[model samples]
Target: MAATNQGGPSLLTRTTLIVVAVILVVFAFHALYVYTSERSEIIDDIELDVAESLKRLSKSLGPFIESYAVNEYESLVTTEAALKRHFAVIVEDFEMGEILGQPYYLFGQLRQGDGQYVDVQARDTSITEQLDQAFYAGSAPIIGSSGKVLGEVWVYASDDILVKKLDRALLEELFTVLVLAGILSLLLTAVLRRYFFNSILGIDAALKNSDQEGIPKAPVPSFRYRELAVLSNGINTMLDSIKGSRENLKIERRRLRNTIIGTRSGIWEWNVQTGETVFNERWAEILGYSLEELAPISIETWMTLAHPEDLQRSSELLDKHFRGELDYYECEARMRHKNGHWVWILDRGSVQSWDEHGRPLVMYGTHQDITERKQAEASLSMAAGVFRHAREGIVLTSAGGTILDVNSAFCTLTGYARSEAVNQNYEFMLASDHHNRDFRKQVLSSLENEGVWSGECWIPCRNGSVFPTLMTIAAVSNNDNEIEHYVTLFADISHLKQNEEQLRQIAHYDALTGLPNRLLLSERLRHAVSTTRRHGDVLAVVFMDLDGFKAINDTYGHASGDELLIVLARRMQTTLRECDTVARLGGDEFVVLLPELSSGTDCKPILTRLLAALSAPVDLAGHSVHVSASLGVTLYPQAQDIDADILLRQADIAMYQAKQRGKNQVRFFNGMDGSAFNSRLVPPASSDQSEKQLD
Candidate 1:
């Protein structure tokens, strides 16, 4: 009771101190505002006065400068002192301040090139220092007859005069301010002591102690002043409300504690100044440690356990919160668990109070486990990296076949940009006519049954080129096992298709002449034989060997011989009907199959043409060489029942007979008699020709 009754500064004394502080603040603010306003007004007036003086001086001097321009300063005073005398009268006419008084206005003219005073009739040499102190100055370029800037005419007003005027005005205002402040402070002090001090003390006494019910034990009476009565009544009302708030706060705190306990999240409080930390049992459990085992924990315990990679960033966020750059601190970081594995924690906190200098005094926050979330994020990042960098083209589409995203490989394969492909139907970029309704249905069915479809397709490119591709289409499902999207992976097979065609050509044709070789020739002969037998028509085989070809090859080289063979082969093909076949059976030997013929006689005309084409002179390396053919003709469906191979052999035998009968002649084999039925010769050229035959 004695301690409670100990005297301290009285209410009246504290109130007086507050009033004095308020008065001083008001005085400072008023002084600053008055000084700034008055200075601004005076500066504006001085600038305007300087501008007016320049206008007047320019008007007075314009006639003189123009005259000097025309007359070349002949009638003007050239000496500086004489010029200053002439300008002094003009300056006096403008009602400028007295010369002996404080310098208010100064005028001068200076040569533009040298910065020296111009030798005008009225240059004022003594006013140079005053002009240097000018706060406001104006100048007009004095141009000469040649349109060059000869000098500048200037007028100025010094700030010294303006400053002196402001000082006198501010002194007068300061006296007025002192009188007003004194009167206001006296009135405020008297009013507070009479009307507010007693009432406020009475309310303070009533609130000093409370009964078990938390109601004020002593009642405060109303004051004589209306404002004092209102203040006393407001304190009583606030005390009653405080009792109800305290009960509600208790219930709310219990509910909050239960919510925190149900969540099983760690709670913590940190004393920033003392470097101490308090943690609940759940905080220790999050890291697989018990409260007793981690009992003597401080902030350093958390720092040491935090993963080194994460501690720096977490600390930065906490500093931001402390410095008020952020409203709160929230960071996800890892800590070393008791089991030696890193555990992720989401730490969140905010300053609860600050010291006098605004440093954080206390911080409160919680921790939550987020290891699973970080793991999932890492997995997602890896999948995204694969999609971006994979070699095979991959396209992701919506379930409805709308193109959603494509990897770089897909863009390269289809020649479509990502912007052009997205939001468009997948068929717009990669699908060909082969992707018909049936194909789509098959894909959908496979997705429904097996969740994937792999097949070959022809995909189209942006340039209207189509190429084969091996594609795999898969269905992507959500957690509920419903199709969310479709993934398509494909590889371009155009090069593979080209390689296959090349291999087929290599297997079936002569590489030198690009004609059907023996293998392809046999196949064609069999097909011709079958067709001729079925139609009851004749098929003839003419086998030809070039005459003097080996002699020409030995003389002109194999390269020339090969060229002659290619030329002759092409000529033979042009001479025969399109249905007929010409094939190279080996060096200098060829077989022609003529099908759908009426008789062996129908082949005579073709044979004659082949001999004529082969006998023509060929130009090889600028040398004219001539080669001839020894032809043997045979017919299919003979009475002896000869097959294609037998027929070939029979024609070959007849060819040997033709070679014996003198080269460059045709011999037809008569199957009924098995002899050379007929022999014909290509008519010889004129005697003047240099063509000669090999022995």
Candidate 2:
């Protein structure tokens, strides 16, 4: 009963106060209405009086104004006692000198002491200014006999009169409102005490005896008034609802607990003010521990287990959540596990309740173990790094052979940007002149049969140039053994190809003159023999030795001798037909093969040209040097079937005979019989040439 009484004032006192407030409001509105109406009426009456006086004055003064009777107009306007009594009057004269750029008016005032009209000194004031100074004003026009308005007659009363009238009316209204409000409050207090006082106290008592959760212990009894009775029934219904809601809340809490357990997430509750904390069993399990092992838990326990680098960030996020700068706190941080290794945790929470001062009081959150996810992310990052920075150009293509992606090395090697390369066909990088449809089909077949294909290829670039690359293309398959994509790895092998070409050049050609060496000449000679036999054509093998090459080498240095050999070799090569071959057998010794000839005589003209070419002067070390050749010619299909070596020996024997006969001459091996060879000298194509014979 004391608690109910201590809550606030009794029902009677509160009702009286409410009634008094309502009465005061009503009186205020009524006073406002009365004040507005009375002021309007007073202003209207003053205006009417001023208008009537102005009209009478204008009528009396119009005649004087029309007749130009200035004195009479001034006299009539000034002596008008009725107009001057409550208003200031003026008579405007059209013929008067201007004041303030307007017609000056004669001013008149009524003296309050004697109630007489008196003229004041004329002042240069505008008529609009005079009207603004008055509370109420009216005007009429003064006309001449010709019906033209000469001037205006304005009458105005002072603001003092309107102010005095409003004051007296407001005082009377306020007094009446006060008296009515006092009587209404007293009557309201008595009525409320009799009808509602006891019923309100009973309701308060019932509410005070409610359970801890605020469900009422008993329903409010019925009241005498219909409104109070309805309120009582509503209170009883609310209590019944509270009981049902409490039971449902218990069931929902159980279900939520079960759901949390099923998800395997850790649950935590914290009292932010007291530094107290509560953790579920799963919270400890996430860190590889039982709840018993983490006894006496508090907020400090979490801080101790958290990685030192993460504590500062966690504190900052917690502060932001407490200050309402964030809707909730979420952080991914590492914590020390029971096994002495760091474990990644996803910590999320929100402030569930606040103190009266709006500070954080209680918080709830969950923790999820994310160590495995973090490890996977690290692995993916490492793989991406390798793909981006590897030395080899790597290409990823879809199963349909469209380029999906390429690394930086690919761009560097192919001279195509990543944007230009993606979505293009895989063949865009291949040299079109080097590779054809058959080549692509071969590559595809290889991949289908062996899952990989690797070889040297020419790759074209954006600048219209191509390079050699060692390319390896392999089919990438998924777990279902279906080919999904093709991964191509290639390295620029232009330098390696260059090295191989250099090695080949060193092996096949003469070091001094760049002519075919003995090894190459032998190979070509064998091939030529076979071709001539197949076509049944005549072939000539010529052995030539320089007549005076050793004397030139002795006279000039070996360098000069080499220079002469190079120049002479090039001249001999140009002098012969494209079907013939000229090779450097050794120092100052050369061999020439003439194939596809109709007869042995077809080569005589060629041999003469060779002699003339070798005899030409050569510039060596600033001196002109002349050299000639002793030539020995042998034709294939001799009397007895002869091999390439026998043909060479016969030509050599003929060359010895030519040199013995004379230095510059051509000798032909005529025939071979068992072990002996016959030699016959052949004349040059010109008439000045000589011939010789030997057996």
Candidate 3:
């Protein structure tokens, strides 16, 4: 082979002589081709040329128009100026054309007739696309007092100008081709006579005389024709093609390297020769190493960063791949991050190619960032675990009150475990037997709109024990306004409920005998009066005052009186039916409100039984205390539309009448019913009764 080229031509005087001759011929052909192709194209560009020429002409004319407008001339075509001071604005830019005459194409500055000479309307815009056929509106549109629209101008460039331009281009191209061909033909004959003929003949003689080397033919041929020029040019072009191919190969390699690095995945290259490894900074950073450590880097160093649990398996996979038993190695394992924590990575490596001898040479690969994926999976698992081990009663339902998720605490609270509650409607726990239906609707409302709600609810336990609970329900929603779940947290309030009921009873009843006290009795009295008034029913208020109970307390002490009160309270309780209201009005006083009565006649029997019970007395702490009460009765709705207070007072006054007749007698409050006259309800002293009473 004639010294086959590897990268570039060797520096030799003989080769230099030949290359110069070839370059001269190539330039000759290049000039020839340029002349041949561009001649007609330049000729065809006449229209564009005219437009450009016009633009230059218009630019030169701009200053004169500006000056005429500034002088405020009434007519610029008719006016001449010394224009010495204003010479600067009037100076020609050369490209601007002279203003043409009347009936102009665009802005007409010239008046068509006489006095109607158009005031100048010189345009501010340069190269207005609006004027394809050129036009001029004169200087009036320009500034200053003398400015006037002088005249208008318009014209299309003639086709004759374009034809003349084409003719000139053809002459120039012919001149260029002739000049190029004559210079090339003369230079080639001289170089061929001086260089390739003598150079090749001398090289052949030297090679033949040395006689030690193989029989080699000369690359340059013996020639006098232009074929030698063609041949040399062809060889130079071939050399150029090789140079381009090598440059393209280098570019491809650079692009491949960049693509690997830019992918954000950690790229790595294993060089089996030097036992040195090159890794992308990302790869090293991902594995807790710096790029500066590359020279000292090895696969062994990387293995140390793998998680202990995963290291052995990763090693095994690598071993198998290296032994040629496997084509690739892949495993998910933890690699320490630059921050020193192990992050999970999917390590994959492929056998991209082998060397000529079939020996493993280079491996190219990358590691992907999977930290987020791993964390998301772990978060999901953790959430599931928390749900499994939760302690507070948690029941997650749909917005519609259907149970979706339940925890052990919920089961413990509702006496239903996860297995039983998950598939059932949450309303099942509402205890349809006890809780109102309207409350369930409220719970639904809270879950759908407010995202939270809480109140007392009677939830049925598994054993059918219904309990009141302070429940808080929350709505879970996504980014969109759609409800995902309803979470209910309930704290058992059964004890509070029981205690509250006991408190209610203690508030209204006398703790000593479990009988209605004054507060409850007054309430009942009012209710009785209202009912009697509304229904035309008869109701009575009977008041009784214990006569001897204080004496019993005075002798046996208050302890014994309290006991006596209890005994008498029980006796009075049995004296009347459940429909009647009896209340202890402090001290030794008691009152009864009887409803649904026919009249005071109905209360009469009740009063008689009460008095007998009180008179019978009871044994208290070994002392039999003889206790009697003065009883009085009053009718409702018969006198003055009697309210609770008036009826009770009247009954009390009647009781005083009984006291006057000596204790234990039951009296009816009709009128004339006071014994001590201290009762506010006492009827006015009878004229026949009081005057005689005083006497």
lDDT for each candidate structure: 0.76, 0.81, 0.63
Instruction: Give a tens-digit lDDT track for model 3, residues 478-507.
Output: 889788777777777778988998998988
Model 3 bad stretches (over 4 Å): 1-392, 411-420, 432-434, 449-451, 463-465, 493-507, 623-625, 671-695
Top-TM-score structure, candidate number: 2
Instruction: Write down the TM-score of every candidate.
Output: 0.41, 0.43, 0.41
Off by over 4 Å in 2: 1-381, 428-439, 462-466, 672-695
Evaluate model 3: give its lDDT.
Answer: 0.63
In model 2, the worst 10-residue window by lDDT is 686-695
How many pairs of residues in model 3 come into backbone collision?
Answer: 33
Ranking by TM-score: 2, 1, 3
Listed per model in order, the count of residue pairs whose N, CA or C atoms clash below 3 Å is 6, 0, 33
Give stretches of model 1 more than 4 Å off: 1-380, 419-449, 479-481, 493-502, 534-538, 596-605, 639-641, 679-695
